[model samples]
Target: MSEPRPAYYAAHEGLVAEARPKPELWRLLVGLGLVAVVVTVLNLVLFSVVVGFGSNAVAEGFLTGSTPLAMIILLSSFGFVTLGVRMAVRRLQNRSMGSVLGSFRRSARQFWVVFRALLILGLVIAVLPPYDMGAPLTPNLGLSTWLMLLPLSLLAVLIQTSAEEVLFRGYIQQSLAARFQSPIIWMGLPSLLFALGHYAPAAAGDNAGLIALWSCMFGLLAADLTARSGTLGPAIALHFFNNLIALLLISLPDNLSGLALFILPYDMSDTDMVRGWLYVDFAVMIVGWLTARLALRR
Candidate 1:
């Protein structure tokens, strides 16, 4: 049989009909959900174990002991778990693992462009005066530490963030699109869920609201990018870069950092400062969306 025309396949009417041709959406979603649950549980357990060990070491005044190693191990394990699940799912579906990996391979060039653009954008935002966000750069890390760990840190950020993109933008979004045939369901639902997953227990007052709003907006932009590109490349790149810069470079207030391992030197206590920085983030999302759209057009 001949392959369906691209235009026909892209249409909502035809896409929805095609989505029903296979009876695997629910099964795929359930499997992915199970993996997510297992990862979450394991992370909690690992974190607790690490904290316990760290507490004992700290009481003994051990300089070499720190939670960073424990944190890295937890994150690495989560990445492996997700990868294992993806491999298992592909085998069960009789799909080629090579094809799954191939999607990520084909988008390599675009990924670099996306990363560079966001990195520059992040640098600009970090240096702006109103926020004085760039002040945190001075005490970021020693040259030796940066040279030694930056590469590993970048890899960790990429793996962690890309895993999210693959699960939500690639797997979940595609699965929903294949089943419902409606852009709203495939695109909107995943984004909303993603936003909710970012909810912080420490958020209070207006800060809580702001965090929720930002999460939702980011999710929407990512979902839209996935829909336009017909792949998770742009979203994955955006997410990875957003996190890399935020973790390694950006200097926002302590509360705004939201579970960061290190705190920035600058005090971001003022509400205006937070709002201004948020506006910059929103602008970046607009630029990211435009970039993804143009790339997809090519």
Candidate 2:
């Protein structure tokens, strides 16, 4: 098939629609509920295990609990959410998970090309001077532990980012596009939900609203990548690198810092510093997004 125009709704061109040729509007609502339930139950179970089998005392200290083993389990929870989306696809749309993934042959090649390019950029930045970075947050892991868990952390980030893209840009976007011809309905709706889902009041402190806006922008960019590439490859790669950097390379001094190489100098609760941090993030996100778009053109 000729490549469709890089419009928002065009991402659905390669998807399968055997069961729900016209997926009812209600189906998407129900699908979201199902995914929420699956993610919640899995998270609770995983948290319980990490807390040594439902210990409230353990739960209270979980945030400061920076064990390599605990980090691995928590990060691995991302994979189960992906499984939840796959199950939802089978039940609601009656389509294989591959349909949401786009054509494997194409997605696989694009995924790697984007990943390697982003990875190279990330390495270069890592070696650059700290410039305006304030005080460094306390290091959580020793050298030996960080080296040991780095592989696992990267895998978890990939699974986590891929899962988010599949749900927002893959299943949800394509499903709506199949029913609605307007790019507004197909693209805006999913991106809106994507931003809402990322709202973090306590974690982001006063900057929560800005983060949500950033997420919405990110959702739009990912949707654009999905349309332009005719697959989830570039979207996944973009998200994967974004998270890998935030969650693993340098993390806020908060709950999920177990696998990080460096920690922020300021507290997440510090309003002024976080605002500054967000400004830096905006620059990275914009550049990273453009890189992916340029890769698609190549």
What is the TM-score of each predicted model, taking all chains together?
Answer: 0.74, 0.88
Runs in model 1 lying further than 4 Å from the true structure: 1-25, 48-53, 56-71, 84-88, 91-102, 120-131, 134-138, 251-272, 295-298
State model 2's lDDT: 0.78
lDDT tens readout by residue for model 2, 46-119: 77676776467556545453544556666667677778878887888888888888899999999988888888
- In model 2, the worst 10-residue window by lDDT is 1-10
lDDT of each: 0.58, 0.78
Query: Cα miss at 130, model 1 (Å)?
Result: 5.3
Candidate 1 local lDDT, residue 181: 51
RMSD of 1: 5.7
The worst-scoring run of ten residues by lDDT in candidate 1 lies at 59-68
